[model samples]
Target: MAGARVTTGSRLGVRIREVPVPADLDAPDAWLLRGQVDTVNEVEIALRGNRDMCRNPHETLGSMREQRYTTKIRLVAVDEDRPGDAADPARVLGHAALHLPRQDNTHTGEVDLGVRPAARRRGIGSALHDAALEVARVHGRTMLTTTTQQTSEPTDGPLALAPSTGSGRLHRDDPGVRFALTRGWSLEQVSRYSVLDVPLPADVLAAHRAAAQAVAGPDVRVVLWESRCPDEWVDQFALLQTRMSTDVPHGGIARHADVWDAARVRTIEQQFLDQGLGYLVAAAEHVPTRTLVAFTALAATPVTDEFVFQNDTLVMREHRGRRLGMLVKTANLQRLAAERPAVQRVGTWNAEENAHMLAINVALGFRPAGGTGEWQRDL
Candidate 1:
């Protein structure tokens, strides 16, 4: 139960309260969760011209239950006068989530904050940020990281702010960008958001896969699976995941290697299943060694047929020269098209500095859709 509410400066009578996670979507307080889903979807649509990133209420609740290095706290800004029901889209003026990693990087916290378009300039966002900051301080977190989305790269000028990486820029006037800058946050890195319209010509996918296989040589083979990892390959998959933590480009964002093991991998897979989401994984196996060397994954919810998210793509250091990245990615894309034909578009994010992977994406027909800035602040 949410115990207390603090009113903000907005004349809309907006109040901030900690939302309690319900046992299940059917719980009475589930209305709060539904309101959160509505608020997030509206915000994404307003910013990106689409709601492809929105999670359904069930998926939102499931994320709260994840115990793998994550403890989630959500705060919602609600209008006192127009406290609408579960069906109301604008009931929640804005919301913020603080994710505290328990196993590692305890000194750091991740924040996700958003406000409805019509409700901006009303102090709702500031109230939520203040509430999140206080909670983070109480938990002993010294650093905070958040992300802002931009639909286009900002040109070199007074209104554009370049990240420390110097590879991408964001408009200084974007509400999220301005909010973070005013709060002492610094731009750390920028990630390019790309989208690929799926169901590529069968011949195109086959040719790409064939070319990658030839470059990878006869010593490596691709293995595909849906939902859970096969018991035989789970441990090797875990090792690839651990490598994924440190192998990627992280710019100036403070982060530690996320340790992963067989058990942890299974836990994450189960979480995805419980959330009513389906995922596809394609791993490159070195035939001689009989071990998984590289992997990539894609996930989608049944809620929408138009969008799917390309989660992670990593090739082990020693395995890099052989084009395993292209092999696993092309293999998975083919599988995704066959298994989830309704998914018309695949969305993915890559660090602007990650040239190799971006090149592969470009060849696969993914065009730049937008960019996201990873911002950090030390408390």
Candidate 2:
């Protein structure tokens, strides 16, 4: 993970240096981690306001560390500073991260950047973006991508307009989106982040389950598991994961189906277990073929049971149009409520153009909380 340093002296006198490890949650490194987290938090709050969409990563740092992913963090500072420099306090004006995949999807690299609210237009973000781009190039990545929360009408009419003078006021009007567009990045897709307030009426849950059961017919059975997938069904789960990439609507983003095997599935399952995270998996199995046709999962951290993230939900192409998607999602939500009673809300993301999946989510009482734009540049 060694690379030449990327530094830029400009509008506000800032430098970008790589942060190799951002795992330590206490003391010295904790301060550095806070600087990085605070800047991103400030930006999110400014854009999303009091919405539940704003993310606070102060406690999730350790859990994010995974052996299978390569992530480099770069801090934009005022003084002559580097990672782990004990002499001077790092005046982190902004920060950026370059994420590269180790196991698969090696051709694409992700760039995450943020600037403090007080230091918005001083070229700090530019420096960090340039540094991340160079690092991606050095790592032999051809595609650079990022996602941003934007405040605008989530409609095709406004989205179709290119970045130009006097355009509507969107979060895109911010420095981050302008910087990406000026640097040759294209808007690939738009996605909506939906939130579902939990503990719906008893009747609602019973009705959803009844509807799913009726749609599933007698041939399809619902299955639930916690944490790890059973050994016998590992291959079936991997196949479904591989199909998710192509089956899900990605809009214009160029992404190949992920290469997943039994080993990869096990690796991920173990990761969640090690992090003390609770997982709920619900799948719809076709009794006649004795195969899993649809599946959904929810990830909840034991440290805080206030919220759970909807991981993934997929139904095989041949098995669609039978309400399996809703069935699996509802079944998993029921399992989460029963097993992890502390969860108050669940969050999920879907491409704006994915009407089918969106319809299912709306049916289950999920509402749009915010929107995200997927930006990309091909090198």
What's the count of clashing pairs in each model shown?
Answer: 0, 0
* Winner by lDDT: 1
lDDT of each: 0.87, 0.72
Query: What global local distance difference test value does model 2 have?
Result: 0.72
- Show model 2 residue runs off by greater than 4 Å: 1-11, 22-30, 49-65, 69-90, 151-174
Cα deviation in Å at residue 206, candidate 1? 1.4
Tell how far residue 109 is off in model 1, in angstroms. Answer: 1.8
lDDT tens per residue, model 1, 1-379 = 2424655553676667777788887877777777777888888888877768877888888877886668888888877788446435367788898999887789998999998889888778888898888889989999999999989887799998888999888999987898999999999999999999988998998899899999999999999999999999999988888887799998899999888889988998888888888889999999999999999999897678789999989998887888888889989988887888888999999999999999999999999999899999998
Error of 2 at 184 (Å): 1.0
| TM-scores of the models, in the order given | 0.95, 0.85
Candidate 1: global Cα-lDDT? 0.87
lDDT of 2 at 50: 42
